[model samples]
Structures are given as C-alpha cells and as structure tokens.
Target: MVEVAMSNCANARPTRCIGVRVLGVSKSIKGNPVLDTVSADFALGRVSGIRGHNGSGKTMLLRAIAGLISVDKGSIEVFGEEVGVDGSFPMGVGFMIEPLELWDEFTGLEMLTLLSSLRGKFCVDHLRSTLIRVGLDPNDTRKIKSFSLGMRQRLNLAQALMGNPRLLLLDEPTNALDEDGQETICRILRDERDRGTTIIVVSHDREQLDRIADVQYVMSDGRIREV
Candidate 1:
C-alpha cells in the first residue's frame, strides 16, 4: 500500500515552479481531431496524473510534449524551451508509451544498453539498480520476446528510469503488474517526485493515481481539466 501520506511525505517544494506548459494545443490525426485545444501546466518536481478513457487524447498530448509528433496549433514549452522548435525532443527526458516495442532478440540488459547508448553511457551498476528498482532481476538474460507481459512492462519502466531523467513521461506504467508490483511502482514514482523529477502520467487507474499524483486531471472529448 502507499503508506506515505502527502502531508507527511518529504515532498515540499515551491508552488510556482512550472515544468511543462501547454497552450491552446490542437491536433488532428487522419481527419480525427484527437486534441482539441488542450492546455495545462505541470508543476516542477511533482507527479501530475491525467486520467482519461481510451482515445481521449491524453497520449497524444504526451506525444506533442515529447516532440514525437508535431501539433497543428498552439505551443508546448518545457523548461522554457519550445518543443518541436527548440529541439526535436527535450533534453534529459525518459518516456515509456504503450505497445512496449523492443527488439525481441535482445536481452533486457542489451536493450537498455543499446537505448542508453543513444544519449550516452550509463554505468552497468546503475542500469542494474534501475532494473532492480522496477522489480526485475538484473541478472536475467532472457530475450524480450520470451518475457511475460508483466516482465515487459517492468522492462519498459526500467528503461524510462535508466538515467535519472529530469522529466519522465509514462503511460499506464503499471499496466501488467500484480498488486505488489503496482505498489512498488507507485512508491518509486512517489520517490521520484521527492528527488525533484517532473513526471506526467496517463492512467485509467484512478485509485492508483490517487496514491502517487500530487495533482490530478480529467480528460474528456480531447479536453483537460484539473481535478
């Protein structure tokens, strides 16, 4: 269980520090308007959770922030840098979206190594510790294709947490976990906020979000409102 109450937790921080900002953002995919002038501010050094039904544009909002896809209108600013204009992807960002795609031939360690190599190298021990944090066995060498769904989810989380990224974007982070696994992940995410990391999470689990989110939002019909 999430035993740390928000008041008692060591998460004190300034209220005015904004990490990510979206303004009048609109997008259409294949003639479907997925994001309809959505806008919100995610506070720095906290976990911001967005709850929405499937295809409500929560994922699309994240993609716009991450520079994965360009939006048709409005601006997304991360740490005062405009996304898609300042750079393709914001610096020091780690994200794990759905579909959990990876090279089936590569082991967990190998896959993380390959991904991490893109930015730079992380110590082997660091990666190993990240794996352990995500409830994965650091010594496991099984290929990704052989991993169970829960295992794959854990791996995806491990990669997102690999470098102690300044910003973390996670979609349904605890998707395939058991009760214990879900608790561990929530604890990790809660602890990340303590470390001054900015996080934006999209989940269907309102209860689980309550455990970790410092602030919550509801999304409907491609619009967002604070909860």
Candidate 2:
C-alpha cells in the first residue's frame, strides 16, 4: 500500500534517472490558445504527474512531448537532444492517449505482435514478460477479445512496455483498472523507473498521483503550474 504521506507530499523519487526540459512551449488550435508559454524541467527516472480539469491541455502537452503533435512555439528536450516539431526523434517513446482503442478481433498477444511489426522492433520474450508483469497471462491471449474493461487496460499497459521505452506518456492509466490491476500498474511503473525510464502521467486521480509521482503539475484553462 502507498504511504498516506505520499499522497500529501509533493516530492518523491524512484530509483532511475531520466531528464526532460521544456522552454516557452505554446500551442494554439484553430486560433484558440491551448497552451501558453509553459516551461518546466523534469527529473529523469522519476514519475511526474499532470492533473487538470477537462480541456486543460494536458493531452496536448503529452502529444507534443511524444512528437505526436506540433507546438506552435517553444521547445522540448530529452536527455540533451531537442525534440523538433517534425517527427524526427527516434522511436524511443511509448504513449497512450484517451479513448483507448483495441481490435475486438485480435488477441492481446496478436496486438502486441502487430504493434511490434509497425515499430520494426520485435521482442517476443520481452513482450510476454511485460504482459505477465502487468497482470496479464500470455496464455490468456486467446481470450483478449473477450476481456473485461479492466483487462483491456492491462493489455494497453503491456503494449506500452514494449521496446523498453526510454520515455512513457500515459493518460489515466488506471481509469478502468480494479484494485489489483492498479497495484500491478504501480509496481510495473516503479520497475520501469528503476530501469531509468522517464514517465509522465496525466490523470485527475490525486491518490494515484501521490503514490507514484515525484512531482505534480496542475493545469487549468490550458495553462500549467507546478504544485
């Protein structure tokens, strides 16, 4: 169980070290500002949580960092290399956005295989291990199509662990998980941190954030401020 103080504390640390730096980042969609000159430095190997009400631009920031979306202004850097707006950064990131989608026809393992093929990197052993780590049974692949909502969440988490991504961006990772699934996620995230992966989580769950996050940012009206 996570210590009660962890939820209230604003600072915590995981064993791994991964670094992020942002400067003057801003974004506008169709003339409406979504992010305005946001800047912050994130310690590598630690979990940083982003909390905000709906429409606060948390998703945009994660997409920008993952090179999935463009920023109209400002810059993002990982480890010392600038992540240009153009998707030139190497595929060292794993991300999960809102409205998670999965094929009802494909088994969980099949989905993993498909994603690995798309990324041009396949590690079957690693993939199976990740699935197991996230509380999924490889043998259960055949039943993935029939999995419950919580099972689907575990499948998604397993996919993100592929390639041992250097950075991970997750949005409401525990939204559909049960207590056990949530605990599994926390353990996997902690293990990833031990391996030096930088994790950025966007969620409104204060209790979950307190358990895993080393720092927290609150977003409102498309602007972000550290808390």
- Winner by TM-score: 1
lDDT (10s digit) by residue, model 1, range 107-159 = 89888888879867998888889988988887887889999888889999999
**Candidate 2 clashing pairs?**
17-44, 18-44, 18-45, 19-44
lDDT of each: 0.87, 0.81
Model 2 alpha-carbon miss at residue 53, Å: 0.6
Q: Ten residues in a row with the worst lDDT in model 1?
A: 1-10
lDDT of 2 at 67: 75
* lDDT of model 2, residue 169: 88
Highest-lDDT candidate: 1
Q: After superposition, how far is residue 20 of candidate 1 from its true place, in Å?
A: 0.3
**Model 2 TM-score, all chains together:** 0.87
Distance from true location, Cα of 44 in model 2, Å: 0.9
